[model samples]
Target: MITRLAGPAMHRPKLILVLVGIAFLICGAIGSMATGRLTNGGFVAADSESARVAEILERDYGMSGMQLVFTVESDGGAQAPASAARGREIAERLRGDERIDKIVSPWTDPAMGSMLTSGDGKIGLIIATVLGGENDAPAHAAELADELTGARDGVTVHAGGQAMVWSETGTQTQKDLALAEAIALPLTFLLLMWFLRSAVAAAIPFITGVAAIAGTSAVLYLLTFAVDLSVFALNITTAIGLALAIDYSLLIIGRYREEIANGRDKRRALELAMQRGGRAVAFSGLTVGIALVGMSFFPMDFLRSLAYAGLAVVLMSIVLTLTLVPALLTLLGDRINRKPLREAKPVEQSLLYRIARVVQRRPAVCALPVLLLLVLLGSPIVGVKLGLPDERVLPTSLESRQVGDLLRDRFSGNGLGTVQIIVAAPARDGAVPDLRDYQAALSEVADVRSVTGPAGIFSGGELRAPAGPGTTAADSAYVAVATGLDPYSEAGQRQLDALHAVPEPGATVLFGGFAQQTADSAANIAQGFPYAVVWIAVVTFLLLFLLTGSVVLPLKALVLNVLSLSATFGALVWIFQDGHLGGLGTAATGYTIATIPVLLFCVAFGLSMDYEVFLLARFTEEWEQSDKTRQANDDAVALGIARSGRIVTAAALLMAVIFLGISASGVTMNRMLGLGLALAVLMDATLVRMILVPAFMRLLGTANWWAPARSRGFLEKVALRE
Candidate 1:
């Protein structure tokens, strides 16, 4: 198959390369525009109960929640007439803005005025409801912030809220994407040059990386028309695209160099290299692509968008590896080796080879300790706490984060955030038992600060005031439950759980707000996780079995990959969640983002499989060549590591470097992702691939090639071998 394609390509390499360049230029330009089309916010499923309640509240009650906040600190005191004047001025100014739906401040509603004032009586808030969707909030907020903040007649004003958070998140993500590329690209080019030892050869991978990224970006742009693409997908496009392109190119070009040095003519060498290297790249791309497809099983657009971006990257890398890289190799010919430096002396008993031999000699001795160590590393996840993404996910220095901190620490009522409990009842019920029981039950729950419903304001199981004037739905009413804890914290989750467990008579209760949204997000992920796992497991097993023609090897590979990820998870929990590495410029959030584990699993598992296929392909080749003996098994293990270990190590290091650059992002989730996946790839390549693989294979011996005799025909039909 490869020979047929390459034979024609060699005849017109220049034309093919030129067209490839043109396509890249066009696709890249289109893809660059994708950033503008991308929207943020997929932390919770839109169809969830929390989402439904929020929708009802907004559409029916005209309460779209606090989209932006203006903070005023009085040079005097918050209760002073002068301070009230400034707060009122800011509120009136916001009301005058056509974009704002409503502006609520201590100066506007005397009943809730004190609640909006700080404890020290120096700060007051004006919470504004902006017109637009979450994606539009940032632009509106930016404009409002510029006008509302700085100096407002003798008072200082600062603006913040979810709208500002999303807008700033989008902005920071774009900057960080550029920063990661800036850090990774030059280093990657140097690494490629050092490894290939030819500037012309090194340029091949860069070209491939750029084309893959641009093509992926262009695909993402097209996807924006069909589905809501997350701005986060841009980061995925650059990181995964560049890393995989370079990896596939390294494998292909390395093989081409070896075949040429072995005295094959250019065309024959190219055909042979394509047949072997191209096949491996195809399988690797399939494995990575399958993992991404598994992530798409989740209902959240966040994970789904990643799948879209990831699949584009994988497909682009495969196409370029098969077509563009091969064309470049044909065009360059021995120029790939122009002014070639002398090769390093071959070490028959290198460290990797020696380690493999040692493992093969005493399989249990090597495998058990490593397995134990990985499990130990992953142990901290036992204490994992999941939460919704909040302002804390932003950099600590961000204005939004600072405002959130002040609100949490200094204010009351909505400052702590509210959980809206929707109580549905027919108007014929006349707001009797349904509203009364829900309010009373919720008020009786532990940590319940207050509950305001159609019946009244209930606190500590007693009525504080009669129900305030507001439009009552013909069929439903919303009771706002206030808590003293941040709604994305453990205390808030516990409070929310208690609220849900409360018995409501004659009403259908639906909870909404930050706490409820966090719960709903967790529930959705839990429900979707099994489907993703099943998809990944079944597809990976089938793919690996087809490649190796051995059920035992594929299952073994799966187990080892899982083990490697355990260590990665362990490190993430210990360092990021537990703050063990807080001294290293790490921003430790006591709880992990709920979606991060899922993202890490998809990315890390795919990368693990990449290295797995790379190593096992070489092992299968060696096994096929050797005579079927115990001694031959030993030789295959030794020789496979010798031939492939360098590529695996170098690729792992380079990919890790790229991911480390991603870790440098200001976004906490991206930082966690970068660190976790980098750790997993390094562990998989060194500890699992090098050590555990040889140990397990040695222990299994000839059994590594075993499959049921009934499967022989199927294996012969599908098995990939040299």
Candidate 2:
């Protein structure tokens, strides 16, 4: 297949380049509009209780919760005549806006005055419900935030809430994406030039990188019409696309250069390089792509969007690597090696070969310390706490975060953390008693400050105010329960659990709020996690077995990949969750983002398998060529590590460069992703790939190539080899 593709490229390199260039240009044009089409919210599971409640609230009750919060600060005091007047003016301004569905302020409704005012009486809260769906709400909130946030008429206002936070997060992500690209691209090129030792050869990877990103973006843009995708998917697509492009390019070019130096003509060299290196690239992409597909087992669109983005990027990288890269090498010919930065060393004399030899001699002695180190590094994962993203995910410099901090610290109650409960009770007079009892019971639960419902505002199992208009409908009623806990914290999750445990006889209850959403999302992920793991494992094992015709090799690769990934997760927990690394400019949030671990597992697993495929391919090739003896197996292991060592190391370093640049992002999630993947790549390349693999292979001997007869026969018929 590779030969057939390279045949035309070798004969007509210009035609291939022209056609690929035109396609990339078209893709770039279509992809330029993708960001606007992407959404900022997908963290909730669609089939979860919170989602059902949200849908009911929107469809049956016309309630979307508080989409925006305004913290109004007055110099005099909250009840001062001037301050009160300003607060009323702000309320009236919001009431007049067509986009606002409802408004609640201390100045407008004195019945709930104390709950909306700060403890010191110097700050007041105004909550507004925006009239729109999830995508439209953020946009509306951004406009409102811009219009109302700032000092005006002797009072200062700061805007925040779900919609505002979503808006700010999207804006910040765009800026961070630009910053990441600025940091990663130039550094990657310099490293590429150093590794490839030719400006022309380095350019090939860059070209392929740009094409992959653009093509993936275009695919995502089209996908948005069919299903909602997260804006954050763009970040992963860019980082992984560029990294894979460079990785595959290095593998192909390295082999082509080795073939050329061995006296093969340019055309024959390209053919052999594509045949050998291209097969590995294809298998590597399939492994990574399958791993990413495991995310679809989860119910959250956030993970699914990432899955789609990753799959698209992998597909683009593979297609271009097989086609455009070979064509470019065909055109460059001998010029690909011009102006060498350094001369190449023989495979047997390379540092990787020497290290493998030492480990092979004393497999147990060399393997134990590395395993212990990885285990020690991975120990911190035991304390990992997962939660959904919130204001803290944004930098403290943002206005929304500042407002959120004020609400959490200065305010008397958690208005933004209000747990909205929908009760499916008939809105007749007969149901009023049951609804009031349910509200009072909720107010008496642990962490509950108050509960306002159709019957009245209840606290400590008693009514504090009369029934309010708009809290009841024909067949449903809305209850807002306020608590002081941070909604995204572990304590807040406990509060949600307590709320769920409360009995509401004769009426069905659905909880909807930021806290409930977080709890549901975590539950959904936990429920699906085992299945996703099984899928990844089963498919990865199958792909590896097909590539190597060995069940033992696949199992070894899976176990080693897990160890490396565990260490990576532990580092992330220590640095991002426990807040040990203060130098990265991001503070520890005490909890990992719920989706981040799942995201990292799929991405890093696929990437780890990527390098695994690279090394194992060479091992299989060498073993196939040798006599069937224990000494020959050891020699094959050494020669395989020696032959593919530089390509793997260079690719890992380049991939690390991309991820490290991602670590420079101001957003904590992006930082965690960047730093975690960077750690995973470096550890896998040096410790796992260099030390553990060679040691284990030595210990396993001829058993490493063992497979059942029937399985071997099946693989022989469908193996992805030249």
Candidate 3:
């Protein structure tokens, strides 16, 4: 059934495409090195208890600043005070560092007006108030941490607070990102090797994926000039880029192999693949781009930059895979298939195939059963929790975690954390708030412990603190508060609401706390939801129209894609939020993070549509050749189902394996992604791809490809442009 063009139209010019890709690669390399550390516009890592404490001090506490908390430990098991004296020496050293605005260790806390040390004296702390901006933070903090490592033989530095959290998270995040690429690329190579049965073809996609990530990183580095970037951006950028590289290259190579098997010569097979598979790939890339770009609705600068970063890689992935992979195929040709694996091929029909056939036969029976199952998984969304991030990251069995538990139990949620209500411009001469009035109002509220203000600033209709030589009106006031709610508790969320509600007459009020972080994240999602819908719609139509050359076809796919994605998201809400999955315990990332709905959709839509494209591309090809609607439809189901179905199932299983591996890493973010991705992959591979898709197509009949001739011609032109 492979048709060869009789004239010059069959062959493509390969040398030019190769040169273009090389040029892009060279340019991309120079860029990554320059921009690797920029935060890329993520909301500064301020949604934490430390941030909340900072906010409370600036707005409510009548102070100019605050201090951090660190836990410096030693597993060296020293019995004498001399060994413990070494830990004290490290604290003393840190107390004298120049970058340290001030320090509060056992020797210094009395002046800072704080606790000197823990009761046993084994664990000592140094509280430092940094003087410079976030830019100067990592290097300074790292230097400080490195300096402190000397006093004890086996010191385990567990640092938290804004400074240490950002620095350490950045380092660990790089490791995670590397781990993802390290795992994905090798696995892709193994899968490709098994599929193409040749080391060359297998290596080509892996190489292309690496190139795309490398190149995208370069471009992203430059993007940091115009925007902020996250410390975690580098790892995520590489991971996403690598994933997409394999995806697009796999499509092209698969088509090239299919063309060759259908009796076309190597050169002709490359052309057909570059044309057909390239067309599908370009559309798929757009779909992924839309998913990535759609995050712009979120107000968090981190998300905005993250969206751009992901889109950049998807575009680069498409470009490199379509051009470089094809050019490489031109050179490698038949050698790409040189070493086919020698294994017993499974029978054509499988349990998945049988289920698909049943759906094809009865349609509704196939759709209803799986649809219900997804609904059940998503029942956890009702009691969703959201909030500031903290590094209570260790297990309950760990000493630090255990001590924290004891403190919470003894003090009824005693915390270094604080929540603030910032009444903006309150210290201006005419507009200065009455400290007596403000304090009285706040005191009336449940948690108000103390209120401090600027020089001459008043609350409770009077000045709460004596006017001092050290104070200024421009400086914000600080308030201290007692709390019945745990800093991490759902009940604490109400504190955020009250803070935001504080009277700001002729001024502004900001709630800065862990509760506030969660509140803002939730609020951002609530407000941005409509935009997300519009974004998804625009993205879905554009990708679908490009793929099938029919307005109707893309719309139909959109309907199902939405259905499938929502089903998956809904399930996550249920299992994680409702705690319906009893064994998972309190460990889930509380209702999948405020941003996860969008993240999940971006990932799930592209993946779900993956099988759709594979199936529809084959089906459409058969229909066009035969012009007998029923015959072509049957051939597509039989052949398309026969060919792509196996690959889809295989890819899903592999993807599941990778996700499951990360799930074992014990990071909350990774675990959520693992569950969501694993669910999406499995469902798309079987229920959506095997059952719902075929059922819908069977119901659509000839109308599935109903584009006016002019439109089809337009699509053909579009394909050429692609």
Clashes of 3: 44
Write the number of the candidate with greater lDDT, choosing between 1 and 3: 1
Q: What overall lDDT goes with each candidate model? A: 0.82, 0.86, 0.59
lDDT of 2 by residue, 198-301 (tens): 89989999888878878878988988997788988878778999899989989999888888777788788888899999999999999999989999988899
lDDT of 3 by residue, 326-409 (tens): 667766777877634223243245555465566677877767886677666555445556554443332343333444443444
Measured by TM-score, how close is model 3 to the native structure? 0.80
User: TM-score-based ranking, best first?
Assistant: 2, 1, 3
Instruction: Give the C-alpha miss distance for residue 707 in model 3, angstroms.
Output: 7.2
Report how far residue 86 has shifted in candidate 3, in Å. Answer: 8.7
Best by TM-score: 2
Candidate 2 lDDT for residue 22: 95
Instruction: Evaluate model 1: give its TM-score.
Output: 0.96
Shift of residue 668 alpha carbon in model 1, Å? 0.3
- Winner on TM-score between 2 and 3 is 2
Over 1-722, each residue of candidate 1 has an lDDT whose tens digit, in order, gives 55565555667888878988899889978988898888877778889998999898888787774478878887687767877887887788878887788777888977777777888888988888887776676788988787767865577777778888887888889999989989988998898788777788889988888787788888889888978888888886678888899899888887777677667888888888888887788889999999888879888878887887788778878877788888898888888786532354454657888888888878898889998999899898899888778777788677787788788778755554778877777466555354665687789887777889888999888889999866367567878887777788777888887877787667577888888888888887898899998899899999889888788999998888888887798788888778886814655657888888888888889989998898778778878888878778778878888777777787888899899989989988788888888999999988898788889888888898888999999888767665
Candidate 1 deviant stretches above 4 angstroms: 1-8, 152-154, 338-349, 412-416, 426-434, 583-587
Q: Each prediction's TM-score against the native?
A: 0.96, 0.96, 0.80
Error of 3 at 647 (Å): 3.8
